[model samples]
Target: CPPKIITKSATYVYKLSFTALYTVYDVTNDHHMPIRLKDSSNSQKTRLQYASWVGDTNALAMVVENDIYLRQSPSSEEDYRLTFTGEENTLYNGVPDWLYQEEIFKTFEAIWISLDGTYLMFASFNDSKVGQMNFPWFSSNTVLTSDKQNDRFFFPASRQIRYPTAGSHNPEVKLWMAKLSNFSNIEIVELTQPAVILGRNMQKKHQ
Candidate 1:
């Protein structure tokens, strides 16, 4: 007999929209409708990067504009903001930066949910001091023209990326944890690294 291909029913399927927005669809219902945020304003939706359900629960954890947001329930209207220092490419909350993705974690997110779904932990990255590398981009349809002086000219455009080279300033990473509840009184506590990892230089720098 051929291998039995058993298919299990899924509750939700996550998807990224064409406009780079994140959406979740509930499959339990016959209509299979999308789970929308309570305040699904165009601006809010546009800033959302990704969303995922908490462990075995209807609660949702999401990242919007590099910051973290938590909703206790799918139908709840209140969205709890987690971190306040998320800046576009310089600082990231609940997500990894370019260095972390390329050299360290090799993943897009740095968020973790507790098994009981009572707490959420995430990593914040600050790459403000890292050196940047610029890349020139040209479209396939770009046309090249030569001047009478035998010089070629094209569009003056370049893409800049924060890159840390050997023995350069690395990104500062911090771990944060928050307890989840129905109320709005959420407190974030920073977790510190071990003494062995901090070493003498790290301790002196902090001092």
Candidate 2:
């Protein structure tokens, strides 16, 4: 299904206006609506829970919910309009997925408009090799082809995740930076030392 479209307006005058949009689904009806708040507005509304935004006073450096989206402004409207598909890769800007944020502890994965609100930065995780495991419990105690007995069945294929433990090998980590003006000019920063550990200890002596 196609995404819904919505419009918002500002209430107060400022250098910029920031707004956030969220979607709320109606479990009873299986429908959704978009929620938005402009700079001048102080109240929040409940709507579809698809997208959210945090904009600066001037409406610049607006952090969108998803990665890729389309922005438009009608010739008559004063504020810009946003429409997005539900895909994260296309709409969000700086946020990473669950694994990258939780497992890797990467909190600041996104870079949005510099001090001047002219540039943006974003990071991505590529864990294509990760695998999954599936077990069949209902088939337990059943007899299969030939002499095979099934008490518990494991899937023939399993997913392998590259996780690093205290003494395990870790994957290579790299940092990338890009200018909003020219996304093609991405710079990759390599670290000479990939891993580091810090610890603290306390000792007390009786006087």
Candidate 3:
């Protein structure tokens, strides 16, 4: 899970989690909770891990776990104060999945901002056509039968994010900017001709 970020006037507090445990780390104080091993019995137990923060204090960035839905909250006591329901076939703002992040070099998946304490931004991706990967495992218990070793395999659905290879059809990219206020305005910048590279050997590269 991603840490809970609490930003005060001059300090930033991060409540990070690893496996099933959590710790508090502060940026202004330059301090971190004592590191704990996942398995004390094994000397090589893995330590908790977390994504590093990027961008300035006002526009913070972090990764969420397992392609889960995310929302903005004003306080920890309240649930997400804002819900983002993006297009039916696209990721709701944030980093792309593992493949896109590693393969396409799209590290930061989403963009957020704090304007006068009101958070806002455009963060979404459309990967409805991406391919799916699956795994097989044995069930430890079954309620319908007495067998505990029931074997099963399944291929969950996934999207193929129209990744562009060396020479492949690339999806059209569009950019938009909007304001978060009553009677807010939205500007959509359209690109009639896709971006193309001009060079000696890679003169026609499209991005």
Candidate 4:
């Protein structure tokens, strides 16, 4: 008997099968092939948070260390860096922040690939000005004491998370579109809010 090939949900572009490993389905030939990253080191893999196929093509986009990386194919060594403002716990590209995940998108993704696979649109978040809430977290693991009468205690550690309270500074968000091409000079366009919306926001601030 032949091996069974299982596929996941179908996007606007292609039907992808993501299980233990990321696989790309070739529509033209109707076959499944495993995708491999150029950098497969543990450190690089650790930094990678999200990765997905771009449209109906074999091109791939990954969110690594809050930055966006694009490649022509899964095995391409010369990948393109779409964003550069990704900083730890401050700025994020191609992925939403905590507030957006919980309130706006209700998903972990903030990217949209064109059906033709020629363009990529994504959102960036700047949480640098947002206030962080710090609190103590008690660990579940028990530590044994070095004494005749053995005793166990849980250690408390300080935890911090960026949060936007009412009337507080919220995360700055911006939408961007990039042209996916073979050349090194990738054209990126910023999609700004309309004047009407901007004026309404300004009016609300003044009130």
- Compare the candidates by lDDT and give the number of the best one: 4
- Candidate 4 accuracy as lDDT: 0.70
lDDT by residue (tens digit), candidate 2, 82-141: 223223322233444434555565452443435543343444343333332234333333
lDDT of 3 by residue, 67-140 (tens): 21221221122122122434432443344433444456345343444445233343345555544334332333
TM for candidate 3 is 0.35
lDDT of 4 by residue, 1-207 (tens): 322223343221101211133455656667775443456653332234567777777677877667888877755667778888998778988877777876778776788999988889999999999999886765453454563155556566666767899999999999998888753788999998899999999999999
What ranking emerges by TM-score with the best candidate at the front?
Answer: 1, 4, 3, 2
The pairs that clash in candidate 4 are none
Quote the positional error of residue 182 for candidate 1 in Å. 4.5
Better of 3 and 4 by TM-score: 4
| Per-residue error (Å), model 3, residue 53 | 9.5
Poorest 10 consecutive residues of model 2 by lDDT? 68-77
Runs with alpha carbons beyond 4 Å of true place in candidate 2: 1-66, 70-93, 106-109, 133-178, 181-207
- Model 2, CA-based lDDT: 0.34
Name the candidate, 2 or 3, with the larger TM-score value.
3
Pick by TM-score: 2 or 4, better one: 4
Error of 1 at 35 (Å): 5.6
How high is the lDDT of residue 207 in model 3?
33
